[model samples]
Target: MTEEPRLSAQDMIDRLSPVLSLRTRIRAVAALLAGVTGAVFMGTLWWTEPGPLPGRTHLAFALLTVFCLAWAAYGGWLLTRRIPLFATDQVIAAWIGLVASLATTAVVTVVAVQRGAGVGLPSAAGGVFVAVALALVVRAQARRAALLRRKHELTGREER
Candidate 1:
């Protein structure tokens, strides 16, 4: 069996992003679409709330806004770059998905508890799917970064 040629860290990083596999391309597209949707929703929520903003509410609004903004920004960046957009960026995007999921679930749970209503299964499933897909992308990128770093350290030569 023949081993595949090693790729340099820079090369690997470059290769990690841009023009991905079809499945990954789908994930990236989904991330962007969800990011935009979440950001818009959160932005409107933050803007339209009535009454004075209290400390905790303000903080919550800030964090949620930042997270969702990051989600959208990362997605746009990825699309503009047309590359894999790196692992750290992917990690950020994944958190966006997970947060979107958790936040939606939490809201539904809180409302259901208050109103004695049932849960929304479809949204929960969609969120979970987005989270898992982006997460897989993050894991793959982190793994690739680590492997490239280790190989570079051992070989003392960065192969392209």
Candidate 2:
């Protein structure tokens, strides 16, 4: 009788945890939802009661968007190159990204306020709220990655 070959770590992961795959279908869907929601919010702001943004606002948003995209890409690369190593690195990266996002938001908010916008104490508080929410999301992603790794390990799969 012929025996079936054991699956490699990557193959096992692909079959057993499709959801944890890099830029998985679910993640793509989530990204789409987030992008659409953000677009709608920006559209609403642009169409109704559009406040004058500071000249630096566009540059700041662009830079932040780039930073976030780069971070996501790097995470994807890490997952592909070394799936076993991804969880720990991803957790650290997520925290760093959260901090960077918060700093960017705070600096831009302050700039906007200084540009004679009606932004005040409440706006600053809103920045804090946004930062907190971002941190929560990052932490959630990191936890998910860790859980997936643990699940894989518990299944007796050989680490690649």
Candidate 3:
């Protein structure tokens, strides 16, 4: 009797987790980075200013920041939680998110200090970003380690 051929690690990974196309991955990463950066920059600059700003300026800043955050959230969802990205891609995305989150927090804190508004709206928003990004980073690392372990096990079995 002939034995059926076993699936390789790559094949198993394909079956277990469908891969996203390169273009999609790139777009997702870009959107996430740009959105986060824009939001942080706009929010920090707009919210920290002490003088009474015009209503239009407030509206513009608020609209722009919200739009950026929405895009960032969408891209983040695709790369980190919803879609099944490659282990390397996942790791990269997670790290990018962490860096962005750290930057956001830092900017917010600095602005708050400058404005003498300790732990205000900006701080709260930044805290949320850091917390979520930290969770995503931990999750991504765990998933990558798991994939590597599985690959090793499969390779060992194939050898046997």
Candidate 4:
């Protein structure tokens, strides 16, 4: 019997429909906007400081600005890319986001505690961030699993 041809990535994507849902696209736009806005605000504050800041403060500002720009770049890349391999990409991005959120929360909580400030507000905000990041992680994993299942089914059909 003649063997059937395997589907290429593009062929599989064409059959699978839209690469990203509207929600995901909206998230990308939001990330891009938030990152840009944060970077601009931080840069302006740093640039307009009337007095000389400590070296540590300067380093902190620079690091924050770079972090914002990195998120902006990631969002822009996500928006522009049309490849079908983003199921894995989304999973990776989601995990990175979760880790970042956790780290930021820990830092904020520690700083607030050390400064003799009430930890209530910081803890609440951190909880929210962690929750959202966790939700995204879950959604990304589920989406990736669904895609893999569909890919397997399609490949099996092609073999038949």
Query: Of the candidates shown, which would achieve the greatest lDDT relative to the real structure?
Result: 4
Q: Give the C-alpha miss distance for residue 115 in model 1, angstroms.
A: 21
**Residue 51, candidate 3: alpha-carbon lDDT:** 98
- For candidate 3, the lDDT comes to 0.74
Ordered list by TM-score, greatest first: 4, 3, 1, 2
lDDT of 4 by residue, 12-64 (tens): 87876757667778978987898899899999999998899976567667767
- Residue 58 lDDT (model 4): 79
Please provide the root mean square deviation of candidate 1 (C-alpha atoms, Å): 8.3
Which stretches in model 3 have alpha-carbon errors above 4 Å?
1-86, 157-160
Write model 2 residue lDDT over 7-120, tens digit each, in one string. Answer: 899998676653355554344445445545555554555446457765565655555555555555554544444334445544555565566657666776777677766667
Best by TM-score: 4
Scored by Cα lDDT, where does model 1 land? Answer: 0.66
Lowest summed lDDT window (length 10), candidate 1: 81-90
Colliding pairs, model 2 = none
Model 3 lDDT tens row, 27-77: 778888988998999899997989999665576677678767866876776
TM-score for each model? 0.49, 0.42, 0.50, 0.64
lDDT of candidate 1 over 90-141, digit per residue (tens): 5665566566666655655655555666567645665677678667767866
